[model samples]
Structure formats: C-alpha cells, structure tokens
Target: MKDVARVIVTYDCPRNCPNCCNEHIGDVPAVKFEDLLKYKELVITGGEPMEIAPRVVEMIHRLQANGYNGKLWLYTSCLKTTKWADRAVLQAVNGITYTLHHKPSQKDLSDVCKLNKYLLENLDNRAHDRSDRLLIDSRCYTEEVLRIIGLYDTGTKHWSSIKPLEWKDDECPIPDNEELIYYDLERV
Candidate 1:
C-alpha cells in the first residue's frame, strides 16, 4: 500500500459524450496486474469499463488472489452493457461508481435499487461498506433524485448515494516510477 493511482483502463468508449475526456488523452500503455499491487487505492476508469467486463473482473480476482488488500474502485457509466449487474462487479472490488451522463428513469432507478439490495444481503458488510454508487450528470441532477438508496449498519458510515458528477480533466497522468500497465483495460 503506497501512493494513490488511477489506471485508465481504456479510452475506447461506445458513447460520444460532451463531458467525456477519454478522447483527449494520449496513448495509454497497458498496465500489469502485479504492478497494480503497489497502490493503496487503484481507481479503474475508462471510456467505459463495463464494455470489457470479464477482463475487468478477472484482473480484480487476480489482485485479490495475490493478497492485495487495498481499495479497488472502478468508474463506469454502466450504459453500454449489462455486465454491471454481474455479481463480481461489486464482490471483487471495494466499490464501483457509475458516472452517468443521462437522467435515470424510474426503470433505471428501480434496477439500481434491486442491485443495491442484493449486494447488501450477500456481501460482508462487517469488512467493507457498500461502496457502490451513482453519479448523475449535474445537469441531470434533480431535487427528487436525492433520496437514500440504502443504509449500511456495519458501524461504518457508508451507503449508496446519488450525486452530481465531477470531472478531473480527461484522464490522470501516469505517476513517476510506475509503468501504466494496461492489462485490465485491454484483452490480456
């Protein structure tokens, strides 16, 4: 566990968003699974991570299997694929924050509710709180959208929340002394 790092899993997104910064970045070198163990927190972001869902989870499993106990948080819109609903998406990582650019309909909110409930029932809250979250575009943020999705009673002040979006430019710069291994971004 050392410095914080963000692995730009990929820039190849299916949607062309006005606020998206994926296309603004340079060539992203593929990252190594072992190299990822150096960070205390690894933020897995991309054009859309769920686009390559299986590989994403595989890398997560690999990290945990190798005794990496640090935080593994992912950033995705969950718009392109249903892979977000996969069990390991929540189980394998400490958190998955869905940054959506569009307004969520009743159906979409309901689906999120269903998944949040499922995670609450199955995961070990005693160890980790429900870090899964939703980030609606600030333009899409409505007063009615600010409701408690769920609360975790594991003595940790954590719960799934719907909030406005924040951008850190297009992508994070690769840190010094660290190779930006792309193993989880592309097919390994």
Candidate 2:
C-alpha cells in the first residue's frame, strides 16, 4: 500500500471524555490550506471536528478544488451536536471512525447511536458505497495493546487502538474464544 501523509488537525475537543489524550480544552488551529493540499489522505480530527464543522467543510472544499482525489477521513469522538453534521460536512468527508470508549454510560451509547444514525440518514446514497469508509473503533483491551493490531474486522477494513489506564506486561491475557482479524484500509 502506498503511504499517505496524515495530520491531526487539532487537540481541542468538545467532550471531557475520560480516556481523551488531550486533557484540556483549547483552541484547535485551522489546518493550513497548503498543508491540506499536500496529503493523499487528510484526517480531520480534534476534540470534536464538528465543533469546527464550518471550517472543516471549507478545508475539504478547498482540498477538492485543489484536485486532491485521495480519501478523507474523520477521527471523531461523536459527542458533538447533530446540527453540525449537516449534509455539506458529510459530503466533504469520505468516512468517520468513531472512537467508542470502554464502559461508556448508556447516555454515551445513545449519543453515539444518534450520531451514527444521522450520518447514515443524511449523507447521499453514494455515501453507502463508502460504507467501508465508516467504522466504529471500540477500545477493547487495556492489556495486550499489541494484540489490538489484530482485533480489527477485515470486512469493515477498520481498527482502533486500545490503551488501558493501568497496564502491566504479562498481567492480563486475551480470552481463548476471541478471534483476531486484520483489516487493510487501502484495499477498501
């Protein structure tokens, strides 16, 4: 697979999710148009890309205008409001890999489900052709982070990294019944 240039646009996100890597809320710098033009795959991510949906849409439009034909992906926590997820934003993005945190509350699950439904309903039918483009990255293992490299569903062509708050080598083991699958996104 050809290597694609990727960038994490901002650290600022809307949710105060427990497992968030960015601990504090702050301003997320707008990705320079030139920088967006240089990459084959541009991943617009942040505390919540939806917070800056207007700017994100502008960035995507600019990229397309610049002849960037490569896939576009969004790494989102999906905690933002649905109004921000208008068709224009969905049209600009190729796929979304929603990060599902471990032991999330029922409210959180409901929120995610709602967001997913909105994405599925509002986007064009051709968006389904890009269903391989959407994914749910459920953070499964706190131990055996390496094993995570294999937990993906090959059919979906999506995977997520799991990081435990407390990890000790050889302390936790994966269950025997568990099956491992590898996904190749480039193929999708």
Best candidate according to lDDT: 1
TM-score quality measure for candidate 1 = 0.68
lDDT of 2 by residue, 1-188 (tens): 22343444444565565545443323323334564555566565555666566666766776788898888767665544355544466656666656655555556556655554454456433445443232333353333322232232121222222223342323433234321111112121
Q: Tell me the tens digit of each residue's lDDT in model 1 across 1-188.
A: 23767677767776677646645555656656677887887878776777777778777778888998887877776533235535666666777776655656666555555555665566534456647676767875664544423323222133456567754556644556433434445757
| lDDT by candidate, in order shown | 0.62, 0.48
Residue pairs with backbone atoms closer than 3 Å in model 1 (clashes): 30-181, 30-182, 31-181, 31-182, 31-183, 32-181
Going through the candidates in the order shown, the clash numbers are 6, 2
Residue 23 lDDT in candidate 2: 39
Q: Residue 75's C-alpha lDDT in candidate 2?
A: 61
Give the local distance difference test score of model 1.
0.62
What TM-score against the true fold does each predicted structure earn? 0.68, 0.55
